[model samples]
Target: MSSVDKQLDELKTDVEQQIPNDITVTDVKYEGPELVLYTPDPKRFAGDGELVRKLASKFRKRITIRPDPTALTDTTTAEEKILSVIPEEARVTDLDFHHDTGEVVIEAGKPGMVIGRHGATLREITKEVGWTPEVVRTPPIESSTVSNVRNFLKQERDDRRDILERVGRQIHREQLGREEWVRISTLGCCREVGRASFVLSTADTRILIDCGDKPGAEGEVPYLQVPEALGSGANSIDAVVLTHAHLDHSALIPLLFKYGYDGPIYCTEPTRDLMGLLTLDYLDVAAKEGRAPPYESEMVREAIKHTIPIEYGDVTDIAPDIKLTFHNAGHILGSAVSHFHIGDGMYNVAFSGDIHYKDTRLFNGAVNDFPRVETLVMESTYGGRNDYQTDQADSEANLVEIINETYEKGGKIVIPAFAVGRSQEIMLVLEEAMRSGKIPSMPVHLDGMIWEATAIHTTYPEYLRDDLRDRIFHEDKNPFLADEFNHIDAGEEERQDVADGDQCIILSTSGMVTGGPIMSWLRHIGPDPDSRLVFVGYQAQGTLGRRIQTGWDEIPVPNPNDAGRTSTLSLNMDVSTVDGFSGHADREGLMNFVGTMNPRPEKVLCVHGDERSVQDLSSALYHEYNMRTFAPKNLETFRFK
Candidate 1:
């Protein structure tokens, strides 16, 4: 190696020595104002604030360490600057800056107090500074009080579980004496996707179908942990099978480890990759907000150690009496619908794990089989009357037209896209449109995790469209490599260019405008009547995207500076949505899968979709199949035999 290279290596070694043994540096790069270090260990910087300050002092320049993609641990002045402007009543609890990606996060408890009435204080903070402020509150607890509360809750939960177990055993005894029946229960079904947590158990083996989280506003989603299910199934579980990599289907897998469950987590290869990406990402988000993640980084690592990557159609015996197989769910890349064969008799069950009946440029349609399946656990993400499809071609055409029109009027277009699925879809659409001359070729900028994640996607090509994957594998014509696209990883300088560009389309993440590079773009472009901000995914309730979608003319966003000020940026830009890009199956597609299944299922439970979607889908299923269908509320449990 050259002298410079050698010196860099030496620097790395020295830096490694300074960091805790558990924290492994993934990358070391220089941004404008700081040297940024990334580590996969979420607790790398926690409780080591003094060590961080010492390191920063040695550098004399700012230093940032990100344990996860969305989190930062640093002694940057941005937070202090922002804090100065915050009202006295609004106390700052935690502040972090992700220098590698220019993510400035300020988290405070009692955010409402700091935000003031009508978000006046918040507006002042954002307008003055660029830091994205996220405020959360934790109910105060004395150590003694907390212990008492914990014990009480634990005892109560244990009592309930004991009662349920006794009843379950009685039922099992009766069923065994006569005939026999399998019992199933689903946990962690977020209502937005018609996804659920399913538990299936026989005399010999018990299995968790999917584990996940509910959707809500940032800092508002209290942990939805079902200790009874996890603890009960821990020692005796055959395996935990993941359907897809989406958070609602996979987020809580680490929690299993936290609760002393060490069974293998079985998922598709792509699902495995996505889980690694997501679990780390979630840790960063949680850390930045000064909230301890529901599961620690160590637990995530432990979970990873127990993961077994299974390809679709590869049947494996997770237990003496249980067998597992995965089929293409045709949602996002690597999504799967799981099938389980249990017991010696005629007991079998198939779970449609966020199924996508519609074929896409990415994945094939879900399989229609299991002729003798008894019970079906399915999603209703699009299970409502309002859920339908706009042709993909038409949606792309409309998207191109909007961009062309906005650019013709000398406006820039800002699209807040999800980093993984929606970002890839938008990129594909843009590439096609630009190639077809539907719109002028302007610099298309991609920010946030999309660019990095796209590279990861290429590593697992089988999860994508077969034809596209083959072409890229053999001939090397990667569609993700559009000529007009540019990656923006530099600090504020490259951002300024995008902001000042005459006609450009900038795609950034925190699709809901909740955080990430999108905030910077919004701060710059949101006030421009000539600019357009297009939201291409679902905006969960209480997100800035929802506010914009709901026609709020002005909204309060995070101030880039650490000062506790806010900005009331004018929403002069034309706000729009292209819902077709969602990775979810629409209502018609969902219904089609349910309607066409072979031999039909005896019972169906629909969750994960919005209330309207779930109910409509459930109603439709009831009308058509005359089967038991339900749309359960959060934390609500149902037993099936």
Candidate 2:
């Protein structure tokens, strides 16, 4: 048996020994990255946080007290009792009871009220009831993604509980303890713009920081080489953690599961929800293009079963020696800068995942504080020469100028946007401009995944900026659901009506026009002399979007009338790229991000950009900060301490 197995055998005994005989532990389980004690009386553990806390410390891992299935109150009774327990002011929108975890998820409008003052209300609920209360904020605007997740949770409760239990045991499995050093492998997004992924590992523990796909690449994604580097199978990986939900950072994760990875996937709650929306949409696109994804939707479901939605700043155990705490990345809702504490402070590495150094309409600036950071991995998407960007206000004004110019000319405006971050951001800008009467409300339409992603943005309002959050929670203002914008009706007649109609704005996805609802819109509007196409985000090289942005007059598009046929599209629409709406930090933003780092890191690694951008950013940081800075490409390993 391995040392981890032997150690777990001993650790399980220790956990049993630590608990008094008065407390009955029906079963002690090692769930992948945690040790869960199933007892008939969970209140016994809840009432004494000190006991569980101390035991977790002794084992140097997370310890969860799950009530025995036999001890859990019936769902009907539990629901009624919980509703009575929480004040009506809480506005409980939804409640979920997970028998396996012994957690009652209370999704309420006023989560603070559900929690009560100083958590007295929750404490009372727990003391009186046998379940632990996990309160979530119900968004002012409902999210289909979150609603789907809730429904899926309820439907697959038993299977999900089993998945968690098995995963917990795997994470808690005893691995050899080595306090020597760790290494990082740049799996993708190095000297490249898409497929943001990487891997970090010690002698025994292994985890994937990100497992994204090459959205812009024609044939295959930039898959990680760690499995091959280790000479073991891909299943050797212990955990898959994402910094955000962008397809470039999260698309290939489910495929990993299809390839035999069955461990936990850790990310912020919003990232989890967004991933569910994006990953499935990716497959839908694949089908539209007459190709199939490497994995099926079933794999996505399996991946979701393994996902552990952790809160930002919650120090979570994902490996035997790794404790991960996510800091706000401020790129989009629920985007996070992952701070991995490896081996009891033996080493630490921080990854800035598509950071926005300045505040945007969606979120605050990325965090600069950290207890200790030895190595920092940051995205340098806009770090090339002459990559300076315009301010957000100026960019917004320029967009309005273009929109009004198009509107005045009796033309339509087609914006190709990434459905996740860029879509929501542009929608906000349009809503604000139209609401302020800076531009006329000329029937702004949202199509494909853009509307779905927007719905998700509403559900996680807590991840948004303070000002936006306050308005949504207190004053009941949700800018995302502005009346000026119309969800592109799914009916063929309605879409054709909008296409044939007069001057208006349409927001559609597959930001790069690789494939999405944007193509048909482009096919019809592209040849229009007065119509316009605007690029708000980075148009990855080789994508159709980049071709138009670079003045490609003719393009080939799949015929929507007959999927098997293709049609050549002639470009006459005026195309322009607005600079400031990008989720990534520009050259100045990147420089300032490192400048503001508290107790600067000793080494810096840049990725998520082209060859020039990565090289330029590394050189600039190296010369300016006088720190070791480098950008490693695919399959290259950087061993560090």
Q: For residues 1-641, what per-residue lDDT tens digits would candidate 1 score against the true structure?
A: 54434544655687788877876777664432244566655343533546556777665434655444444323455466567777655556666554434344555534556666655554444434433344433212112222232233334544433433332222122123233446665455545642347777665556777776554343333132454365444654556788877665677788777777755677876676677677677677656545567887776666655666677776655654556778888777788878777666457678888766876666667876763666677777767787776778788888988998898899999999877677887887888788778888888998877776666566566677777666445423677776787888795688987787678999998777766678778888888988898877777666677878999987876566653346777778888887677777788887778778886887777776667877888888889889888776655554444
**Cα-lDDT of candidate 2:** 0.82
lDDT of 1 at 366: 80
Per-residue accuracy of model 2 over 1-641 as CA lDDT, tens digit each: 86556766676677779987778876666665567777887767766657877897887667777777676778898888888889998899888777657888898988989888766777667666788788877766667788888778678878877877667666655667555779988778888987877778897777888877776575557565446322377777878889998888888889887777767899988898888898999888888888767789998888777788888877887776788999999897799999999886789999998899999988899997999999999899999867988999999999999999999999999998988888888888888898889999878888887777877777777888888877677634778767777887665667789878878899988788888788888777788989989999988887888888888988888988787568888888888899999998999999999988996999999998889999999999999999999988887888997
Question: What count of clashes does model 1 give?
Answer: 44
lDDT, each prediction:
0.66, 0.82
Supply the global lDDT for candidate 1. Answer: 0.66
* Candidate 2 segments exceeding 4 Å error: 1-28, 32-35, 40-63, 68-77, 98-102, 137-139, 177-179, 225-231
For model 2, the run of ten residues with the poorest summed lDDT: 222-231
lDDT: which candidate is best? Answer: 2
Candidate 1, residue 349: lDDT: 79
Question: In model 1, which runs have C-alpha deviations exceeding 4 angstroms?
Answer: 1-180, 190-196, 218-227, 231-238, 563-567, 634-639
